[model samples]
Target chain A: MTAILLISSALFCAGVYGLLSQRHAVGVLIAIELMINAANLLLVGFGWRTGGAFGQSFALFTMAIAVAEVVVGLALILLMYRSRGDVQVDQATELAQ
Target chain B: MNPLISAALVALGLPAALALLLAVVPKLRRTGKPAALLSILGSLLALSAAGWLAATWLHDPKQVLDLTTSWLPQSGKSMSQVGVHLDGISVSMLLVVAIVASCVQLFSLGYLSDEPAPALGRYYAYQSLFLFSMNLLVLAPDLMQLFLGWELVGATSYLLIGFWFTRPAAGKAALKAFVVTKFADSGLILALITLVAWTGSFSWNATLPAGGAEWLALFLFIAVMGKSAQFPLHIWLPDAMQGPTPVSALLHAATMVAAGVYLIVRADPIFAAAPHVRLFMTDLGAITALFAALIAMVQTDIKKVLAYSTCSQLGYMISGLGAGSLMGGYFHLTTHAFFKALLFLAAGAVIHAVHSNELSDMGGLWRKLKFTTVAFVIGSLSLAGLPGLSGFYSKDLILEAVHESGNPLALGLLMATAGLTAFYMTRTVVKAFFGKPSHAAEHAHGPGPSMTIPLLILLVPAIGLGWLAGPMSKLYGRSYAFHLDTIGMVTIALGLGGIALGWLIYGMGLLQALPRAFAPIARIANGSTVDDLWALSYSKLGMGLARAIAWFDRYIIDGLMNFLGWLFMWSGQRVRTLQTGNVQDYLYAVFGAAALIALWGGWR
Candidate 1:
């Protein structure tokens, strides 16, 4: 159990760093999926220890959200690539000007 | 119900109707002679009506005819009424106003007939309006009606005084007259408010409330002083001579100036209730009479001399009213009307002939204008209170009243003022008529019959009105016999002495001018410095105050408003920068806030 916890913590930290620093649009989307799965693993682990089904249910809910997020994110990247011919995460910040 | 009532109404209504018709009818408004003729006809109708009312009132002094109709319908309170109260005083006032107005209009027909200006229609219209307002002023039953009439007369006088608006002096003089009278008019407003608040009624029949009765009397007296040209307020009348000559005769000398005296006589009960107020009025009257008389002596302009004399005579009437003799005051007001109007009209005729107002430019006109000379001499005699003249009868009564009131100071000042009146008038006559021909007088000619007729008609009243003093005194519900009282003797001697002194000086050239010892005192009394001070206070001081207020409003009030506006604008601009329209930046901010919150929660 301790080993699993250590691995999941490392995964969450790596996912947060990638999500913030990634320059490519698809790379950022993959980092968000990684972060969501890491959260789901933590939820399942805690649920098994606490002898409750609540954590497993929440993990299920998070997994479904992760799938929906990837779908919308890929669509955004497709739109950006079609418009600019290069889907860079920095180029998506038309909001900043 | 009463014939006098209808006569009074006609006296009040005819002039108003004609003025309205002339003003509203564009066709009638375009013509000059027709307007003058209509005005004269209306004034004559008013004269006949006023004459009938006077004759009726004279037959029975106690008869008071009140005619009223509901003016404003109110739900809770009893409604106010449009009304006229025809009594002895009102009848007498109406008669004097009508007679004088009739003569002035007749004279104006000639004065304006030859005038090259095309605006004579407006001139006659204003004259008619003035007559209407004055008649309304005399006949009004309530304080409200009196005030309305008072203000109407003031406005009409303003219009007439500025009739020749092309001249700068005429315009300035009109403004000065209006402003000064308006300042005094506020006193009437205050008096009305006080009367209404205290007595709960605006009727003249309402006895004044007891608590602030003296203050109310003072307010009314202040209004009278302003209208009558008492001491401090006499400054306007001399300047108001810039108006047309007939206007000066009708309004300034005959009616409007006397309106103040008429008010005191009408509101006698109120003044009687406040002895201190009466004393104050007496002092003001005495000071104005003496001061104006002295000023009249120094004036070089013929009309200015008459203007000051009118002021002095009005002072006599006011002082008489203050001294508790309604008969004396009203009688003087009546007689003064005739002589003063006569004097002004005669002066107008002389000016007409010589085409000048300065005494320096008028001399030896007696030979050229024989009828005007006779009229002027008779008017002068009446004014100087020579025995058996109208002014003697009235001036003696005023002196006796002041003496009987036991105000030694007022009596002395008034008697001395009487002497001064004679001196100045005699000096004016000598300088203008008896001396060698001046450059202007060299080309002098007699005025036409239209002018001469009014003068001749007024001369009869100026001479014979003194004998009517016995009968006229009875109009005030008192039987006064003609007798030379001690004060009467003193005024008589002083009047003769004044004329003798003037004859020795100007007629015979016995002295160069008023004694050299009088130079400094004359300089002070001549009103140059006082006039400057008056001009400065109203113009310079008033402007300074207004500018200071404007500065405060701009810097202090507007500064606060602008500062708040600027603060809102600056903060809005700063807050707008946060809305950078960047989706990534917004997401970053949300996540950073969420992370900070999570960290704080874990620590807790």
Candidate 2:
């Protein structure tokens, strides 16, 4: 359980760094999915240690939500790439227009 | 409502309705005939209403009719009222205004016939508006209503005086008349506010606070000095002759100018309490009378001569009122209205024929215009105060009033002014009517019946209105005999002597110009020096003050506003750079702020 927590914490930190440093729209989406999965992993580890199914069930629901979020996120990135002819989020800077 | 009140309402309302109709209906406003016919019909209706009101008042002279409704209600009572106040004074003034206004409108039809249709329509609209304003003034129940009517008439006078607004001189004269009167009107405004503040009502009969009457009277008299065209302020009036001649007759000579004296009569209770102000009024009136008459003596324009004579005549009315004789002042106002309107309309006829206001361009007009000549002669005779004329009766009463006031100085000045009035009028008659025809007069056309009829109608009152003085006296609850006293006899002799002098110089050509000894007096009376002084004062003092105010506004006031605007704009530009439109940058800021908040909470 301790090892699982360590792994989840490392994964969350890596996701945060990727979100801040990424210039591509798909890269930001993948980083967001990684942070959600890291939280789900911590939930399952806690459930097994406490011998309660409540944490595991919550992790199952979080995983499903993460899957749905990734699908929507990838579709938006695909549309952005089609419009701009590139996946770089930094180039699409004119939010006001 | 009383029948007299209804009559007064009609007298006031018809012209207002006509003016409104002319204003609101574009189709009606563009046609001369409809506007003229409507204006004449409205004025005649107003005249009949006024006549009926006067006759009813004459039937029962003692009854004072006051019918008012709450205009501005406050705390279960009215602060001001709108209604008719028909006493002898107002009724008489109403009749005078009605008569002069109707005659002037009739005469304007012919006088302005040559104008384009739209311009003619505008002229009649203004005339109807003037009539309404004058009648409203005559019928006002309180100082508030009076001031409203007063300003309305002033505005209408401005519009009418600059009726031919295409002419630069007409526009300037109108502006001069408006600004000068408006400056004096500040006194009236102060008096009204003070009266309302102290007494809590705008009624003329409101009991004033301690020592309020004198100041109020003095303030009202200051306004009178401007409206009545008294000395110094008399400058605007002669210039106002730049308007059409009928405008001069109605506004300057008869109704609007007499409003000052009428105000004194209406607010007699206040004026009666202020003896020092009355004395000031007497001395000022006397000086204005002599001064304006002296100026009238040298004027080359027929209308200018009449304009100055109006100032002189107004002085007599003011002096009579100042001497505590309402009968003298008001009766003179009645008679003067008729003869002066007659004179101005007759002058209009001559000007109409010759197509010029200059006396140099008019001569031998009597041969071409017989009816107009006769009318002009009768008007001039009445104005000269010849025995058995309307001017004789009214002028005698004023002199008698001044004599009784024990102001020998005022009496002397008025008597001399009477002589000068005759002299200038006779000089005008001889120069314009009797001398050899000028080049313009040789081919002069005669006025149509539209012009001739009003002159003929006004001639009756100009000749015979004096005989009604005894009956007119009853309206004021006084007795006036028709007998000539010693003072009356002396005034008549001086008048005849002035006529003789005028005839000898101009008629007989005994003198080519005024004697060299009188050059300085002539130069001063010619008005150049006084006019120049006024111009200099206005350009130097008035314009200088305006410039300083403008500078303060542009720099000090505007600078503060500009600084506030610049601060907002500069801060907005600095704040706007945060919006780099990068998604990762916004995400970094949100995470950083949340982390800092969580760290602070944990530490606490």
**Candidate with maximal DockQ:** 2
TM-score to native of every candidate shown: 0.91, 0.81
What is the lDDT for B273 in model 2?
Answer: 86
Candidate 2 lDDT by residue in tens digits, B1-604: 7887888899888999999999888789899978898999999999999898888878888879888889988899889998889887789789889888999999999999999999989998999999989988999999888988898899999999999999999999999999988888898998898888888988778888767899999999989998999887888899999999999999999989888888898888899988888998888899899999988888899999999999999999999989988888888888999999999999999999999999999988899988889999899999999999999999999999899999999999999999989988999999999989999999998999999889988998999999999889998788888877999999999999999989998899886556454567878777666777888899988999899889988988998899899999999888777777888878789888888998999999
TM-score for the first chain in candidate 1 comes to: 0.86
Misplaced by over 4 Å in model 2 are: A1-97, B512-515, B560-604
Instruction: Give interface RMSD, per candidate.
Output: 3.3, 1.5
Model 1: per-residue Cα lDDT over B400-440, one tens digit each: 88888999999999999999889988999988888898988
Model 1: lDDT of residue A87:
78
Error of 1 at B270 (Å): 0.8
> Model 2: what is its DockQ?
0.44
Positional deviation of residue B252's Cα in model 2 after best superposition, in angstroms: 1.2
